[model samples]
Target: MSAPNVTKSNLNFTELPFNVSDSNMSVTESLLYDDEAQEFDNEEKTWMFGAPLLLVFGTISNILIIIVLMRKKFRKSSWGLYLTTLAVCDTLLLYMFSLDSWLQIVFKVWISDETVAGCKVYRFVSYFLVHFVAWILVAVSCERIVFIYFPMKAKIVCRRRTACIVLGSIAFILTGVNAHIFWTFSLTEYDGFYYCDLVDNIAELMGPQFVIIFLWLDLSIASLVPFILMITCNITIIARLIQSDRQRRAATSDGAQKSSTTSIAIMLVSTATMFLILTLPVAICMVLSLNDEFTSTGNNMDNLYFAKRIAEFVQQINSVLNFWLYCLTGKAFRTELKAMLCCGRFSRTPGVSNAYVTRSTSATTQVEHKPKDVKTNGQDNTVKKAQDDTKL
Candidate 1:
């Protein structure tokens, strides 16, 4: 297929894989840019294959994450607050962004474009949820910073109440930041279908700067700032972990402090690592696309667009990733999930069996009468603990 002689003036931003409202194409460009013969096999396969898998698996997995994080043990921890909110946000994002995009691309049925309010609301919610997903992980990292560096203060500082306050404040500010989309996205009917785009006098409403700043600002928030912050925070976290490990090795006793903080640190690092790996490619693609919009002829438009679409498919996969990521990296998450599935019965040790053993021993020792053979001393307790371990 021959490439179209397209330019930014004639380009339809809405005609990406997700929102191919081709009616937005102008007559001059339409004459050169024949959509009937061109096919995006790779792009189509990407959305087709990714959308369902993400919807089904991602939705279920995020629910499992919510359930696991919401357990009583996590209720008081800031980790629970941040992670649970993230799960909820990811769930909404998968449905709103991934599902809607899939439906529009594959079925040519988009409810959002059917009405003006639907269009604006959909735009607002989808963008808002995306900002939430990225920033919530930042919040998680912040929580870990408190836990690992300020352990003494972590209990007081990283509580559920503080997490809730921080998240709520962020949510409120992000809502205001993205609220412009709700006002700017108006449905314009061309031929028979509606296209979501800025209003006709968008310049008057948002000023000439809207065109200059809107997409770039979005890129900054959704990708740039986050990339820098997560990288810096995680590097600090890695350095701190290295220092702690050195101290632990030099000491004769096991580092109780290290043990307590290690689980959350592992979780934070894994989450941040996967988040960067999955999200950065798309961010790069977006940068390319935005740059190409001004610099390219229609020749490589398809290629640049295809790259972004593929990146988006990966982003969808990220939405459903928490469950698998957690199960792989988090012992407590796996233990809780197993417990939830099996009605308080844990599938392994290091969780339920250890707790059960401790409880049973305590009950025996606290009976109305003490056994003459039992000695209430630290040495005997150590011996008894060893015996219990040997029995297990």
Candidate 2:
């Protein structure tokens, strides 16, 4: 039987778990009736089994990232600051959301239900971190574009101090924008289990239509605008990197330079592409699900729920995947990680230096300098001699 339309006063429908259907019976009644069945559906079972494992590993990975980025060699780079901040944000996102989800699914307990103040803190922190992370990515993309297009000016424009200031401003502005959540969320108890939900009083005062409008506005700020910014900046950065590669090839015959540039370009482009791929679905689903018309259709509700759960899963994946992306694609990061893991023993080993020299010599042989033909054999011989000496 189709569930009855439970009173909206008892729970905020939007805050309910995606799998939870709107039924005539209250949330408490539904839970009691389905206690055994609620053990978890296939999707939820997967999340429960896998998410905690990822969370634990992700937490360690982010901590390692933070530690590596804080080192003297990396801390001076503008990208390091953004990456460190991103790691911090990812860590927070996991603890606040992924851990909370595990608890809710396994124990049927909501951390935000502990106290009124806890509700406010949970809602505010969750929303704030979501926006903060998005904007930080936008900042990273913009910084990369500048570093690629204006290498000389980037030293001045993308300083560590500048990154700090930008991050601070982002935190301040986003916190101000999302501060409303602190007051808008409250604990609602049903059948002795408390759920964190939107305050009914505010909903009534604001009206349903107005609330929908506000949600659209929030969605725009939190996802749409940042997504656009990230895509635009990264696209431009990629274009510039390609152009720079061509110019560098024409100007120099250094194979090491080419390899370095290509690796960095791949890293930046891949990171931006991954962000767009993982986040865009969630943004689209959020926008569609927030629309009253879309949710009103009975047949579409199940599809919507599936989409929402998939979106949530992908979003959490995004938070934990950055460390792997960097480690896989970044040569310097791998070196640093190796050193850190070995407690500097790997770095101190003589083989590391010998390997560097071998690679450098090999790289020189791989790329030959193209020279204009000279009428004088002497001049040609002189240039050839110089090239030979430089290679040696």
Candidate 3:
């Protein structure tokens, strides 16, 4: 393939792959732009293979969450409503920004004409949803923290109506932020492919410094704040659980207190574990992006690209995995999942184990057996009866 003529108005490129042969070229389309040189074979293989997996897992898991929550019996809780909405948002993002873009990368084709409108829509959807996912996770963490620390207040504070309003408000704000992307870039045909790039008019106005600042600002809000909040909330939850266990041990040597404390601890630990596992890879990616070496356009580009992809893969896996944590730690979720899988045959009272149920039932029967005369005698008879029962 011969080099395209360098017009003064066009952006210069040093080289492209030889396979970009003479094809039906359009003057109105901009050169297909990649931030780094095309390592199509590697990039294609990764995104092509990984994307479908994300789509399958993300779709199935999120749908299951919606299904379980929408069941008539489980529809009342605010947390259930919030989780369902978050799953829906994640499902949309996975399909649009992740699955669709990745397929395009694999096919080596742009989805549409690289017009300003197309650019804006793509950037807006991608950027806004990316931030939206982070914020939604933050909301989830807050939900969990509130439930753990202030169960009574959480019931009142995070009701279904309020959750719906919060989620809607988040979507609106993010949509507005991303709407600007449409006005900035224009389509140009260069070489043999079409793409949208910054119009010279707009690029000159913002300058490189402003662009860098914007990128960092974007990173701070989407990544940094959410990461900090998740870590802090998870840590606090863990601390609360530990303190609860200590108090339970000191106050009650009884099995019921121990059992309840253990249940709460398990739930907190499992939630924290999922969050840490999912977030660690992303935090590492963010740190790597800051290093000048990792930000370079050549080999570093391939490394950083794949590194970010790995982070995203982990995040997608996280979405599916959290439900499992709920399954493992939550008696309610486990009962519900079992009931769903096995129909009504598996349906049972939540948190009823044979041994614990027997014990609790026996205790209740004992309480119901007090004599009529015991009440008339009051404190002396109560003490005497307790001593006689202990002797027996």
Candidate 4:
């Protein structure tokens, strides 16, 4: 009740789920709760065992994104900048989440529950990053929409400067918004063990209406609004892409443009779709759990919690999947990835004799030696055009 009871033999401390008082609970209900608890443990093990894989995978994948995007080809691309920032954020978010989860399950060390400051800071940091990442997805989505719908002005509208400003604004605003979590969560003790949770009298402290409003607000900021934007953007992008495909079909000279549009379409749709599928159930769980939080005796609480844990695990998979998505969907990304993996043994200037040309013509290099300036400019323009084409 006042956080999960430590002395209760049937109970275990977890930072991820909220607790309800066991007063007047039925034996059947207790058994049901224990059953749900077992299921959650199994779920935890599944993700936990996969944790190291994800750690290696998510780290290398996100790092690849960062490294690939930071290359000279994408240096001036707004979307490239956005994606690089996203990769960095995902790396941090994944580390924070996976490490906490790993520690909680393996060592049974709950950092948030260990100290009052730890409780608040942990919540604040994690919540801030979650909100931050969601909106970054939204930001990229909006930029993609702009690129698709308003291609002529995309360069003007979506610049690296603009991206940096947008990212800074998001971080600043979300920091202010999630800062309340520091005070909202307290290190609480029940039967000699600790939990990071709200006070039992939270309703009395903040008023029931305020807490309700806050939860709804939290749901909106963290999930609902972004989900709506993502779906909307996906729809708009698909339609525009269809129109572009038809138009490009009639034009013979625009073969390269067609390829670019296809790649962009795949990139946007795959990323947004992953978010939509994974986040939907999390939002649903939040909606279902809203009313139950106010009740002293939790009704169907185990079911709600089961749903929540499942949704959370699904959502987390998104962070690790983006690099693969880009690799699969973007031909250019695959080319670059291949080139990187092969260590440039495959790189050669088309139509130019390698022995006669003493200079490397690959776009990955930043040196502007006079002999290669022409090749560099040509590559830069091609990359610029492709970047412009990808805005949609």
| lDDT pick, better of 1 and 4 | 1
Note the Cα lDDT for every prediction shown: 0.68, 0.67, 0.58, 0.67
Q: How far is candidate 2 from the true structure (C-alpha RMSD, Å)?
A: 9.9
Kindly indicate the candidate among 1 and 3 with the higher lDDT. Answer: 1
* Candidate 4 segments whose C-alpha is farther than 4 A from its true place: 1-10, 13-34, 253-262, 292-299, 348-392
Cα lDDT of model 4 by residue, 29-54, tens digit: 67766676677777678667866776
Tens-digit lDDT track of model 1 for 1-392: 00111122123344544323467867766644455224355566667777888899988898888877776556556777788888888888888767876886677667666789887887777777877778888888877776667655665676678888999988999998987877777886554555666776778998987865777777787888887888888998889877767766565354453343565577778888898898888788667656745447665666566566667778777778878888887766776777668765444323322222223223222322233455656456545644443332
Q: Model 2 scores what on Cα lDDT?
A: 0.67
Off by over 4 Å in 2: 1-40, 189-193, 254-256, 259-265, 345-392
Clashes of each: 0, 3, 5, 2
lDDT (Cα) of model 4: 0.67
TM-score of 2: 0.76
Tell me each candidate's TM-score.
0.78, 0.76, 0.70, 0.78
Best by lDDT: 1
Which regions of candidate 1 deviate over 4 angstroms? 1-39, 253-258, 292-294, 347-392
Q: Which lDDT tens digits does candidate 3 get at residues 1-392?
A: 00011121122234544333445544322244343334334445666677788788778888877887676445665656766776776787677645654756555445434456775566566667667767766776676676556554555675677777878888898777655556654565556655655455665776656545555656765677777887787678778767756755665566254342235336545754575577567666666666776667646645665566556666666656656666778665666666667665553433322223233333322323244444534566655544443331
Order the candidate numbers by lDDT, best to worst: 1, 4, 2, 3
Report RMSD (Å) for each prediction in the order shown. 8.8, 9.9, 11.3, 8.7
